[model samples]
Target: MRLTRFTDNALRCLMVLGLEPTECITVHAIAVRMNMSYEHLVKIVQRLAELGYVETVRGRHGGVRLARPAEEIRIGQLLRHTEENLTLVECFDPETNTCPIAPACALAGVLDEALTAFLDVLDRRTLADALEPRQQLVALLSRSLDPPTPSSTELAS
Candidate 1:
């Protein structure tokens, strides 16, 4: 039931972007804010952009921003996109399954139902729902971190 680090980072990146919807924040800044590796965040951002979750701008003043409103970004949809493998059990993937009792395993069906129910709950929620406590999140994020710095070009502009 646990999500991968890639999905985790993607969610965190979206939350940071949601915090400043009108502005483009650099990947480096996001990495700093989220305490994530810059390199790892870059890959996440690239995938997110490819999935149309975020838009990227290039150049010295370039940064990233949400492609759509937080309310339109469903958590379940995002999870489905970010998660490379959703297979909870070996039997979930027929091609690679090595389970000897997969054909008769009732556990697979039960696990599948549980997984569906989990995603169903997330389907009902959106990024906006997660960010409902905006002020609280902002306060906590700012408590120990300095404000993200603008690029040199952005400063000149």
Candidate 2:
């Protein structure tokens, strides 16, 4: 049950935003801190804003902030917004599927059960639960974000 990069980035962005002490955090800071391309994150922020997950403020000193509290934002809810489909197999969506073996394939049933289990677990977890691990993540990310010093070999060049 691999999540798409889009979903992954969105989740990361949300987590970063959640980590901030202030009510809002600039997109530039978020991108720089995470070492992510600012251009791509723009789209993710726009989409989340449109979905009412994050609120955006314009002009200087303005940025994005969470639309709701971390505990209030359930992981499953955001996942549904970010993901296009949960189809683990062709028969998962009847509207677009015409597989000949879909009717009686044991594989479809097994996959269906697997997907359900995966979703059920995610559905049970909230962003608040995920935030508990932030202490370690934030420390690691903060160190990684520090500007690299030129090594002796690179400086010689």
Candidate 3:
């Protein structure tokens, strides 16, 4: 099953935060490091903040940091929260499943099984597990230490 770019960016943001849990990092810095758009990353970060994964602070020194420990943040849980749709096939969504053979589709069952297994594997992993040997991320973030922050007008609005 393929994850949407939105979910991918969420995971990347989580990984960045996981790598440096103590320091708050700006969304612009994360966007720069991950080669993503600042605007798009802002929307993703808003969702993450709503879900309690990342905490945002406003003002000149405002930025974001992980709300919980990386080891405590399960990958599967975050994926489920970040992903709006997890259906592997059209049959997975009852409202959209128009296949005539859906009632007896063996392929749908198999896909369901595969999806379950995929999530199960992620369930066993945590953000910390994804960031083991964090030197690379540490270096990336260190270079972003002085990136521009959103202006007060931008943050206030």
Candidate 4:
């Protein structure tokens, strides 16, 4: 099953914060580095702040940092918060199920098992897991802090 872009971006935000546990990174910078929309990242950051994943400070120097340690931030839990829906098929959502064979569909059960396995694997991992080889991640994300330059394709356009 494919994850929504929102979930993917949320994970990226968490990774950025995880990379610099002590520093408050701006949503704008993350948007620039990840090539995402600032407005969308702001909303995601707000939701993450509300969920107690990231802490925000408001002002000229205001930005965000991880509210909890990276090791404590479970990937599955974060996905649950960021993903609006995890239903892989119509039969998965009780309120919206309209399939004729939902009542007896073996495929639905198999899909359910697959979903569980998927989340279970994620559950075993944490934000820290995503930021492997600490030094390398730090360097990579540090480079991301630089102002983005136009790509060759964009320059051509």
Q: How much is the lDDT of residue 124 in candidate 4?
A: 100
Residue-level lDDT of model 2, residues 84-156, one tens digit each, is 9888877888898989988888998888888778778888887768777788978977987788998999999
- Model 1 residue 31 CA deviation in Å: 0.5
Number of the top-ranking candidate, with lDDT as the measure: 1
CA-only RMSD, every prediction: 7.5, 1.9, 8.1, 3.5
Give one digit per residue, the lDDT tens place, for model 4 in 62-91.
Answer: 799999999999999999988888888998
Kindly indicate the candidate among 2 and 3 with the higher lDDT: 3
The lDDT of model 4 is 0.89
Looking at model 3, residue 54 earns an lDDT score of 93
The segments of candidate 2 whose C-alpha lies over 4 angstroms from its true place after superposition are 155-157
Better of 3 and 4 by TM-score: 4
What local distance difference test score does each model get?
0.93, 0.84, 0.89, 0.89
- Clashes per candidate (backbone, < 3 Å): 0, 0, 0, 0
TM-scores for all predictions: 0.89, 0.88, 0.86, 0.87
Candidate 3 whole-model C-alpha lDDT, 0 to 1: 0.89
